[model samples]
Target: MKIAILGAGYGGMAAAFDLLRAGQDVTVFESAEAAGGLAAGFKAPGWDWSVERFYHHWFQSDAHMLKLMDDLGLRHKMLFPRPKTVMYHRGKFYPFDSIPAALLYPGLGWGVNKIRFGLVGLYLRLTNNWQPLEQTTVEAWMRKWAGDSVYREMWEPMLVGKFGERYAQQVNMAWMWARLHARTTRLGTYQGGFQAFSDDFAAHLRGLGGKILFSTPVTALQSEADGSWTVRSAAGDQRFDRVLSTTSPGWMARLAPQLPEDYLKGLLELKHLGAVVMVLALRRQLSPQGYYWYNLPKSAGFPYLALVEHTNFVSPEHFGGDHILYMGDYLETDHAYFQMSQEELLERFLPSLARINPDFQPDWVRQSWLFRTPYAQPVPLLNHSRHIPAVRTPLAGLYFASMSQVYPWDRGTNFAVEIGRRAAEMILTDGQA
Candidate 1:
């Protein structure tokens, strides 16, 4: 069967790889000039390794991604680094990676508050069943399990920073539970970065007789009377026995208007949080204690969500001895910060960077890059699972697979690959039937 897979991200590419392995003809369509989607990377002239536009890292629990790397013979390039993650509250940064660190930190207070915080963390980490927690809000769960002190000092700020004002009573506890359970203290990344992995994946797919069309966005998707798919793009129209879309559901709705009205309503009901990240190539490190992630509390009065010193986790030597930092925020698309220019964003964040390191100077920044995406995060509300579209859509020859389908586990490269493979399996099974 000839298949058309839209979007050349990990998910789409994964589907193509599986289909090609089954002796099916596959073609991948990517709007961008390159692949990898959100995990895509860029490089400077003197840099030997590429850096992701937005900060990215893998947890030890990312089994799907690890297995794929091993299968692709790229597992040797994986590096597991134990980087220091801290929290900024009351004008100071405190290490907050482990239970001991949280207990020792003054932000959560002493005695019962500390014990409550530790117990809450333990509960979240040990939890494997998320169905019961789906209807509960993170705010309510945190307050009930950890008390108001812990919620205000630790979780609330982080939630507000990530979800803005909507996080107070809207975000689900299942999302939080999954996040806590799926992440480990040890973080992993490829030696050359994810873009290298993606490029290799695409090349391997091509070697398997699959075709990838870059810089070609699917403009329209039409269903034929005989149960085939017509995928229209700038490159031209092509007929495929099956078409799987790895783009966002919102995008799928636009591309294929023939979808059922109920399906489109479900797609529109799934909310997404966008992201704006400012990547800086600096002459010197910003964090004095070499912390990789710094979660800012509302008390800190910082504008952005978190400051991720990428070079702190990896090494500056890979980028010609320049320290790389990411000032990133997840916000609604209408947020003013989302509309700001690179120069304007840099101006606003530079002062905040100095607060982290008083010695930070304007000349310290060698170069800066800004990346913005409209669908960075899928906001999981109560009973979000009910809204997830089926891999097999109402259309006979068309299927939908996207980040939104990877529920309970937040959107990431690992789940993307999993969903993509599942979509391919569904297509193959249906074809056999």
Candidate 2:
């Protein structure tokens, strides 16, 4: 079978990997010059390592990501480190990585709030049944079970930071449940970077005779009377036995107008948030306390949702002794973060740095890079599972898989790989059928 995969992101690549291994002729089309999609990275001169454009890491619980690495023979490149993660409280950063740290968190209060929060967390962690939880919003559920103060202090800011004020209260409880159920304190990363692993995997796929057309965007896709699909690009139209699109639902609808009107409308109705990240190389370390991750809620007057000291997680040695830090947030397309120039954003975020370190100065920055993606986060509204598009679309020989489909579990490379392989399996089965 000849399979065409759109978007050389993790999902597209993973699908191609399985299809190629299954003896299918697979060709991947990526808009970017390299693979990795949103998770791609850039390298600078004098740097031994490349850093993710949008900062990323894996959890020990990410079985799909780990298995792919093991299959790629790059499992040894995985590094799980106990980097300190701090949550903000009354002008101080405190560790919240373990049970004790969570219990000791001053923001949750010393009495019933903590008890309720703990009990609620334990319930969500232990329960395998999450379908029922989708009926209620995280805001309402947490407020009812964990108490208003607990919800206000902990969950609200993070929710707002993720989905923004518009959809924050609309996000379902199952999304929150999947997050706690899937995450681990020991964060993992590739020894070099995610891009390095992706590049290596692409090379390996090419060795297996899989064709990856990086920098080639699919201009159009439509089914033909002969039962094959035409995938048009700058290179030329290519007919394939099947087509899988890993692009956002909006992009998919635009590329393939033959999809039903109702389906296209449904695709456009799915709301999502973009992500803006500012990566800085500093002459000195940003977090003086050796902290790697910091949660700064907007409710606490913080402009950004997170401040990640990447070098603290890896090492400055990999980046030529320059410290790496990332300040980022998920926002609506109209948000100022999406529109602002990097210089403007730097000035706006600089004061927050002073708050993090009173003696800090702008002169400490060596270089900075800003990255923005419009479809970074899918808003998990009430009863979100019902809206997720399947790997096999209503259109014959046309498939759709995106981060939006990885519901209950938020977007990550692990689930991306998981969904991609699922799509590949369906394609192979349908071909056989």
Every model's TM-score: 0.98, 0.99
Q: Which residues of candidate 2, in runs, are more than 4 Å off? A: none
lDDT of 2 at 399: 96
What C-alpha lDDT does candidate 1 achieve relative to the native structure? 0.89
Positional deviation of 163 in candidate 2, in angstroms?
1.3
Error of 1 at 83 (Å): 1.0
The digit string of per-residue lDDT tens for model 2 on 245-297 reads 99998899899888888778878989888899999999998778899999988
Off by over 4 Å in 1: none
- Cα lDDT tens digits for candidate 1, 274-363: 999999999998888899999886557787888999999888889999999998889898988888888999998899888999998999
Cα lDDT for residue 303, model 2?
82
In terms of lDDT, the poorest run of 10 residues in model 1 is 160-169
